[model samples]
Target chain A: MEISKGWNARKKKQLQVIIAFTIVPLFLLILFTYYPFLEMIRYSFYNMKYIGPRKFVGWRNYVQVFTRPDIIRTLLLSLYYMVGSVVQVALALYLATIFCFKVKGENLWKGFIFFPYLINGIAIGFIFKFFYTRGFVLDTVLQVIGFDLENLPYWLKDQKINNWSLVFTSIWRYMGSNMVLFLGAMMSVDDTLYEAASLDGANKWQTFRHIILPSIKTIVTLNIILSITGSLSAFEPPYVITSGANGTGTFFVVMNDIAHTSQKVGLASAMAVFLLFVIIVAKFVQDALFKYIFRNADTDDESADVARARKKAQKAAARKAKGGA
Target chain B: MAKTTAAKVRHHYSAGTIIWEIIKYASVILCSFIAILPIVSCVITAAKTPEEYQTTNVMTPPANWLNFSNYLEAFKTANMGTAFRNSLIILVFVLLGSIIIGTQLAYVLNRFKFPGNALIRNMFTFAALLPGIAMQVVVYEIMTNLHLVNTMYGYIIMMCGTDVMSIYIYIQYFENLPVSLDESAFMDGASYFRIFYSILLPLLKPAIVTNLILKGVGVYNEYYCANLYLQDKRALCTVATSLYTFTGPLGSQYNMICAGVIMSLLPALIVFIALQNQIYSGVAAGAVKG
Candidate 1:
């Protein structure tokens, strides 16, 4: 971890210039990022009094979180979101594969796919909410089909269905992005490989499997890990969908659910910490599995893909190392 | 044989290709419709008479209602004037501060090759590591202590701290530039700042613009932080905040909200379309593999 060896004192002193640039800024980052996290973990063990001394509640709060239906529901809703994210990213890979081929009118397809990703999730939530509730392409058709404006289903509204609606919006915004990633990965594939495969009478499916899929294996895995991690800890959209200010929603739906509404800052902090742990563990396991499956088969990947994949794997490993530390 | 095979494959487009192409084109068009639908619905709802909107489907209305007056009512009623003023100020400060400061930090990190350079660069990369919401409770605590809560400056400062993406872009671009440019200027006895100003700064022009477009549009579109931070109605809020009032209970005026959504997204959308080329390349450059 130390700098290159054999530098004199003056040389090392000069090295402070670089250290200062990163260390100083990093102090700010850690202050904002890690400190609160540590505080939240610490607070999770204390009683719920803002004024009282930090008393040890220990396993009591953790027990409450795991056993309580409402808290358990929060964890379940997150699982639903994870499902949506995985599916959406998978679809994106399919779309990205097509884009990689640079079929006719790629500009249009690329724009359409990434269009939702450009809009913030909250805005997309509001936009979709408006469309489903009051607006539509053919109101009369819906009416004839027995859909009533007076009793619109709450995608972000009802507890029973709010999660599904939020999942759709996530897919809408994220599908294109995954597509773009796949496209980028596909572009990195050498043209000569496809040419060779074609000479062997590989059809599009065979080409995709024998060529495109194998080429972008590392990227696909990276996308999967990111999607899983991001979705598990997802927030904001459902918060907007239900309008958390009015209150009927999931655990993450309300911002001040911890310090304010639930009056369980400790509980909320526990929830957040739990989410962080799940993400880290999921990513770690995902990286190992991906590396195992594709490592040998993909050694022949072009230098760029190899470098990119190694960087991704290294970062994932570093994160695991950090978690362990 | 390779050429013949390539030709043979090209000549024999299978049912899969045809089906795949159909699905791709159809979905592309279908998705475009879905993507553009909300904006259209919002606009229609805004322009059409309340009775027309309530009685009919939002997407279809008499052609006569495509008027701009819904915007006037919305602006006047929603306190949009104040929101616009607030957003404008936020944009100006955030754009100048985040980029200007981020670029400086990026320069030292990329060119200096110091001992802790990897850690510094990793700090920016790892900003995206934590769930942004997890950090919010604490940032809220800090901002509250700073007395920046609900203030325009509070919001701008919060945004200025959104340097992770901008810093990443700057580092990527700076890395692409040769180090000789900076060393030669330094050898001429110029100060670090002087070399940055006269040589590196000029060389970094393209990146600066790309960063501005990506970062500007991103900061403007962001709502989560502002929603969390802002409270006072009298305090300056952005156009984005103003648009939400339409969806509020009893204030759910579909027409006005739609018109307002259109107006709110216009600036960013126009910038996006104008620099679509640069944006594609700029964004490609900023692409994080994961």
Candidate 2:
């Protein structure tokens, strides 16, 4: 009887621990994440300010989001970033391929490149502001390399090239980390595959195409998707450096302006919702495209047995075709 | 046969391969140069006198490398001392709160198979998909209602509230830890809290390090929320927002602004140099798992 009572007490203590530990985190998750999301959706359907009365205005703000030319232009600015992200991914993949081989001072090269990823974003903004200033670092470097001072266009002042310049800054800041991620994935690839490729007289490019590319395709796809989604909400470079001037205002920056400066809470909420919808749609399309492209590759989530069977069947079919040929 | 193949491979390193090797090294060198060029310019500018800054090209060496008056002036004018203090305070509380909250929640979810276990996990997973910045409009409203605007503790709490990443990290770490440890501790008549505090928490050092590097850098360098919520520039300015004090009337002073920018970067630079390996591995591991 005494032992039974002791066991009951222990069970109660365990239950208490479970409840006590979980309650606060759950409350926080609900309050900060779900509650705010629901509130944002509700706010999207009403015309409101921060402090004043709110009136129900069904779908009007969302209609404004689709029809407003300035807002539409901001959304279109994502194209620059989308192109930049593609460039960033390509540069990162190229660097990763180089560094994965035996290179002198590999760590030093990587350290220099990856250092920017650790920099404060605001500081990078200020540094680049000085860099792109008239007769500053970029122009001076160009002059030393034999370009005339009169030939150099104003970097930040000219709308034609300013967005591209900002895009380059984003690429510079992000490319190194993406390279590191690619390096990690490549390093984790099975070594025996490389040995087999070399034994088969496969050259470097052939080995990269057959072994490295196929193995790290998942990470490559992931990086592309992440960068594309990230481009849709590009904020820091334009926000900090140009303050969204000279045709560089991204979707988030303009939404921030409307919300804070103009005090249009409802409109901002609608814009936010619209962006979320666009990102979700983009994610789905990318997932489908990747699935279609990588149809023959073994998926990461498949069981080893299933993958091996598939490989065996493929090999048998190949052998039969060779014999017939 | 292996030795012959190795010799043949060595013989295949011809002029074409040599040219390719040269190109590779040159490109790597060029990339590294570009990476540090902007910072190098800023460093040079920070050391120049106002007159020297105006006369010399940006790539030119400062006349006096020891001219640190610009740094002193920038520090004083930008009120950086207070900014650093506030930032440090916020980092301490937010990290502490996140660690405790994240670990406790992870422990409960991992060890117990209660009624709401799957539901809670799904909730967090769904929350990860939600665009956090998009919900900021309503979050700002909620913060205003809760009187959390313009307050440090409020910011700290809000930071702690959004630590879904760290919680996931802890849960992943917990999966590797043997439940036998808990069972053995329980067999010794120890309380559940005792088992958690004494045994399991010590084994979570790696996860803690990873979380620290990720969360510490984020909270330290966070600008947007710090600007919006901590509105009092004089009292609540963080290291991020403190540099903005140079953008108004003092914006044209490149030397002073460069000094301020260098000062802001110094802490992260020092930490990076000190813990480069840990930071790299931590970041890689976090990215892969996340």
Candidate 3:
């Protein structure tokens, strides 16, 4: 009877702890995140500013989101960022490949490159503003290299060059972090594969293609998908540096403008919902395709690359065992 | 023949290999230079006076490296004291709140096989996929309705909104931890809170560090929502929005702006330089796991 009473007390205490620990976080999530998101969906269907009465406009907000030429044009801005993300990923991969090899001052190089990722986005906006100002940092650097300043395009003013300038900053800011990730993934690849590949007279390209690529394929695919979403959500560089001037206003900036500046809360919410929908669709499709490919890919257990890696690892282990013996 | 070739390839420093190695090193160094150049230029520009800035080229070194007057003026005009204070308050509270809330929620979710555990987990996963920035429109409205707009408590509450990443990190950490510890403790008549605080929470150090670095950096550098929610410039200016004080009427004061920028960059730079390994590995782990 005493043991039963003690067990009951323990159970009650456990229940108390669980409820106490969980209740606040759950409340905060419901209040701040989920509730607001649901409101976003509801607001998307209404015709209301931040204030005053709302009319239930049904699909009108969504129609406007789809039909408006200006709104449609804003989305094309994502193309610039999309192109930028591709280049960023490519550059990151290249750098990662180089850094993975024996390089002088590799740590310093990694630190320098990754430093920008740590800087406040607002500070970067200011720094780049100074850097891209005419006859300033970029121009001065070019002139020092014997390039005539007169021939240089205005970095922030010329529409043709401005987007590229913004894209370059994005690339600069992100490339290092991505490289660090790629490098980490690459480091996990067994070293014996490289040794064996070299023994088979495989050149650098062939070694990378056969050995490095397969090991890091998961991370590479993940980066690509993330890059797509990142491109869609590009905001900081444009918002801070140029305030989305000179045709730099991407989708998010436009939505921000609608909500804050124009006071069209309902329309902005619709835009938000639309963007969210696109992102969800993109995520869904990527997940589905990845699931399909990964499912099939797993079935190919006897693939040559896997076989080589396995054999190389086994050989290394065997050598270690022999040495120990 | 294979042994001979392998040995030959290992031993020989061919001209082609030498050239390729040089090119690889050169490319890495060149990119590093590109990365550092703008900041180097900013440093140079920040050192110069207004007269020096107007007369000399941007890349020119200052006459006196000790001229800290611009930094002082930037600090004063930007009211960065308040900014730093506000930012610290926000960071401390947000980090504390996230760690507590995230670990607790993770604990319950991981330990219990409740009716809605899977549902809750899926809900967070779905929330992670939602473009959070896009929902800012409605979030702002929610804040307005709650009278949370332009309030510090509101901002802190919002910032502490359960981070999906931190929760996942904790949950992942918990999964790796053996449940026998808890079972044994329970048998010893320890309360659930005691089991958590004494046994499980201490084991969560590494996960906590990872979450801290990732979430701490994010909250520190977060500008958009901070600017939107905390509209009172003097009272609520964060380290992020404080620098924008120069972006308006003082826009042409490049000298002062550069000073402000450098001041802002200093803390992050110091942290990175001091704890390079911890930061780098933490970041890498977070990225890979996420």
Candidate 4:
């Protein structure tokens, strides 16, 4: 009883020490990371295009984004990118399932499938550019099918098809990461469950649908969120592939326009703010649904406040002994 | 006993054999080939003569292949050397600074209950959720104001905004850990810095190493920020930007671009492969602790 009381007193001391060092840095995080976010919100209310903004306009920027044809076209292009990403993720899921079984040099196949993902988008963009420009790709195939080589449309040249080409490369880059995530989820299923299903005379499709699908539901949500967020924030390849002139792939081309070319800092900030809100609100909605319901299948809740308090107590006790001396 | 033993061995064999046989080696081989075709296309294109490259289909084998000078041209023509150096410089410091700053910030945030604890948590969460494009806007403004635009420090500073993944990863791992180890250190009269450096940092190695790889990978691969903030041809060019010189309004160099890409890609590729095990068991494979 005496020892327990002493331990408790010492733990309290350690917690005190951790809090002392933590104060200034935490303030800085709030100042820089969070404060700018608030500034983003405030900036959204104005046409603060050149930093010297005194006029107050309410919701007009968002109104312009929604009603304007150019912005709408950009939004649809962004949606097109999402569709391409979804298809890529589905393709990855299909391929990962195919690779789940035993095979010769299984590791090699997995590595190969995942290779495109690790390459820099600029490099991939350059390679795809080479294929599109003077050599054979879709254009080559088109030529074989009787289109003239000299007048062949750049595979990524057309505004209509540029988004597709960009998204295909995006998928190529990210599908491996998706596959690995889902594959990890797949590997977690207990062998006993499959054995029991086999004993019950389940066919391959039935076993897959009944066992595999149910097991990966939580992971599917995670992947969906990743895909949605990834598409919305898409850049790099399109920047390299399109070089931003065609205005084909993402609405975020506005961001580059505002920054590097046009120098419309305020307009860029407005676009950025809108994009941020869309992502955060969407993620929060998913997160809320996730915890209220998806929390049923998967468990990961102990790392919040209780964890913070526990670590603080541990550090406080270490500072006291030297102070006593 | 022999009959039972034989039956048990048979049971294990029967379970996976049919399932494995359905997909088998051929399907796997074909998928693998399809997967490698793009990279293979890139490699082949790099080796082909410019004249041959212009006329031949990339998917088709070249009639003649040789030491393509386009790569030599890529370096001389694309200004790749300066870009490569700038990328290297940013890669070194951004990786170093982000780890140092982010981990120390995380350590404090995860370990303390300071006055603005809720605000701090919200700040980290907000930054994580900050629209990548939107954040770039504010960062551009800030970088410009600080005169950091086109500078290496700008890249490193802009990178300081990070997701909650590292903190939460540390928090989760730390939560699972028994606090007995820290207690011994505490009983020895160590300061917070001592406790953090000697004990907590070591304890959080698995998470630290994982976050290091994850954070560094994306930042190093970052395209949008670099493209936006830097304009000085020498200042802005990383391997990413250098690769862009291969692309233009005019015809792109076919095979040499691929060689340059392979050169840039090989480091991250090697790291991913080498760290695959650590990466899997690290933050990626595990479920995020709430």
Best by DockQ: 3
Q: List, residue by residue over A1-325, the lDDT tens digit for candidate 4.
A: 9999977776676466555545545554554566667777777676656556546777776677677676676776778777977787687677666655434466777777776666766777766675566445556656776888777656676766667777777776777767776767776665555554444444445556655665676767677776777677777677767766676746777566654476555456677777877887888888897888656543323343543353344334333532564
lDDT of 2 by residue, B1-290 (tens): 12332344566887755775788788789889989999989999999998998888888999899999999999999999999999999999998888888898899899988889889888887687677777877787788989999999888888886465777788899999999999999989888899899999999999998888888888999987888899999999999989989887888899999999999888888988898877777767667643
Please identify model 1 stretches exceeding 4 Å from their true place. Answer: A1-24, A49-56, A101-105, A134-160, A190-202, A244-251, A254-256, A297-325, B1-20, B113-115, B121-127, B162-166, B205-210, B282-289
Candidate 3 residue pairs that clash: none
In the range A1-325, model 3's lDDT, one tens digit per residue, is: 9999987786677678778987897787778778888999998889888778999999998999888776887788788888988888888888888776666678899999999999999999999999999889999989998999889998988988888899899999989898888887777665756666666555556556655676677788878888887787888889988988878888888888888888778888898888778878888888897798788564323466766666566556655654686
What pairs collide in candidate 4?
A13-A316, A14-A315, A14-A316, A14-A317, A15-A312, A15-A316, A300-B290, A318-B186, B45-B255, B46-B255
Per model, the share of native interface contacts recovered reads 0.28, 0.58, 0.68, 0.44
CAPRI rating of model 4: acceptable
The digit string of per-residue lDDT tens for model 2 on A1-325 reads 9999987897799899998898888888888898988889898999999887999999999999999998999878999999999999999888888876666788899889888887777888898999999999999899989999898888987988999999999998988888888887777655545554455555556556655675578878887887888888999899889999988899989998998889888899999888888777877897798789778766555565664465445445545654686
- Of the candidates shown, which would achieve the greatest TM-score relative to the real structure? 3
Candidate 1 per-residue lDDT, tens place, A1-325, comes to 1444523543554455445444445555666776777787787776664445667788676777678776676666677777887888777777766655535676765776676666655456557767656336434336766888566554444566656766777787767766766666666666765565555445556557655776667766777777767765666666666554322344565424665565666766666666667777876798689779876765434586674565445445545654686
Those runs of model 4 whose alpha carbons end farther than 4 Å from true positions after fitting are A1-32, A51-55, A138-154, A158-160, A195-202, A244-247, A258-260, A291-325, B1-31, B60-68, B79-85, B249-251, B280-283, B286-290
The TM-score values for the models, in the order shown, are 0.83, 0.91, 0.92, 0.81
> Model 1, range B1-290, lDDT digits (tens) per residue?
13444356467687876786688677667766665665666666777876776787666754566577778887776687888788788888988876667777888877766556687666666556666675576677787888988887877767776456678777788888898887787567666667666778778888888777777767777877777788875455667666667665735666766667777767766776777767665565555534
Worst lDDT run of 10 residues, candidate 4 chain B, spans B1-10
